[model samples]
Target chain A: GQQVMQIPQYQHVQEGEDFTTYCNSSTTLSNIQWYKQRPGGHPVFLIQLVKSGEVKKQKRLTFQFGEAKKNSSLHITATQTTDVGTYFCAAHGGTSYGKLTFGQGTILTVHP
Target chain B: EPEVTQTPSHQVTQMGQEVILRCVPISNHLYFYWYRQILGQKVEFLVSFYNNEISEKSEIFDDQFSVERPDGSNFTLKIRSTKLEDSAMYFCASSAAVLAKNIQYFGAGTRLSVL
Candidate 1:
């Protein structure tokens, strides 16, 4: 079994502040995916990281994969009230096609 | 934009009763999956289906749980005997192809309350 650990289970920040959450895996991951779930909604695909040390940005959000491929991070710059939600980092270990092991998720609350 | 759609946004069942959760994945997607999340908890993978068969399943998917693609468009998860611990939000997801590279799109999820 694989395990994904996420840091800062909860975070509350001013609308203009920055936020970062880290995900760590006990076993090496083939690829990592990021998902966001709003207050009563389902998980929505945010981004995926495949290459080691990969960095991708979507407007104010930035995602990074560690060089070892065992960890990843998501950073949000200048968060807004609409950014309130739970962000989860998921990965598929071994050869388990689409069986994603998800981290506990970081619940972010942006206060205006 | 196309998305996964699940039926009956909420379900209430009694322990030992049978329950079925339905989902309609994206038309062109090749991979379908089921995941569950307890209130305010992380999403947990239950099973993944491809080409009309299960590709992978987690330990949580035991004999009490089953999956079926009854038709070209419908994917369903059945709990033979629901238990109190089975209460959770079940999500249906789909991916285009090559699970390693593609992103999975999730449905709104069905909140199951087993009493």
Candidate 2:
């Protein structure tokens, strides 16, 4: 079985603060993806990391894939109330036709 | 942007009753998938359908669960018998391809409550 483990299950920060969440997979992954689920909303795809040691940025968000492709992290800068949501990391292995194993998620709560 | 649409935002049934969750993926997308998430838990993969057949499934997708494309525009998940443990949010997702880098668009989800 494949497992994606995410840390800091819950995080609360005031506006203008920074936050980061990390994910580790028990087995090597071919690629990893980041998604955000707003309160009572579905998960929305944010970005995907494939190449080893790759890093991608989306506005105030930065995503990094470990060299081994077994871990990754998502960092949010200067959090805002709009950033309140659960961030999840999903992984795809070498096999399987793009089936994803998702992490429990890091729930972010920002206070104004 | 196009989105995946799932019917019946919520479903409540008895422990041994049969239930079906329906999904209509983006018209142009070729890959369809089903996932489940218990309250405050990770989203778990149940099955992946492509070219009208299942390409992958997790251990959680046992004999009790089945999937079908049904027609040109719909993908469905049928639970032969429900259980208290089966109560969760079921999401339908679609992707353009099986590649690692493609994005998967998810539906709002159908919250199942088995009593």
Q: lDDT scores for all predictions?
A: 0.94, 0.94
Candidate 1 per-residue lDDT, tens place, A2-109, comes to 899999899999999999999999788899999999999999989999998999999999999999999999999999999999999999765778788899999999
Q: In order, how many clashes per candidate?
A: 0, 0
**How far in Å is the alpha carbon of B50 misplaced in model 2?**
1.1
Model 2 regions more than 4 Å off: none
DockQ of each: 0.82, 0.87
lDDT of 1 by residue, B1-115 (tens): 9989998899999999999999999999999999999998999999999988898888899999999999889999999999999999999999897558878899999999999
Residue pairs in steric clash, candidate 1? none
lDDT of 2 by residue, B1-115 (tens): 7999999999999999999999999999999999999998888999999999999999999999999998999999999999899999999999998887778899999999999
Judged by whole-model lDDT over C-alpha atoms, candidate 1 comes out at 0.94
Model 2 misses residue A61 by how many Å?
0.4
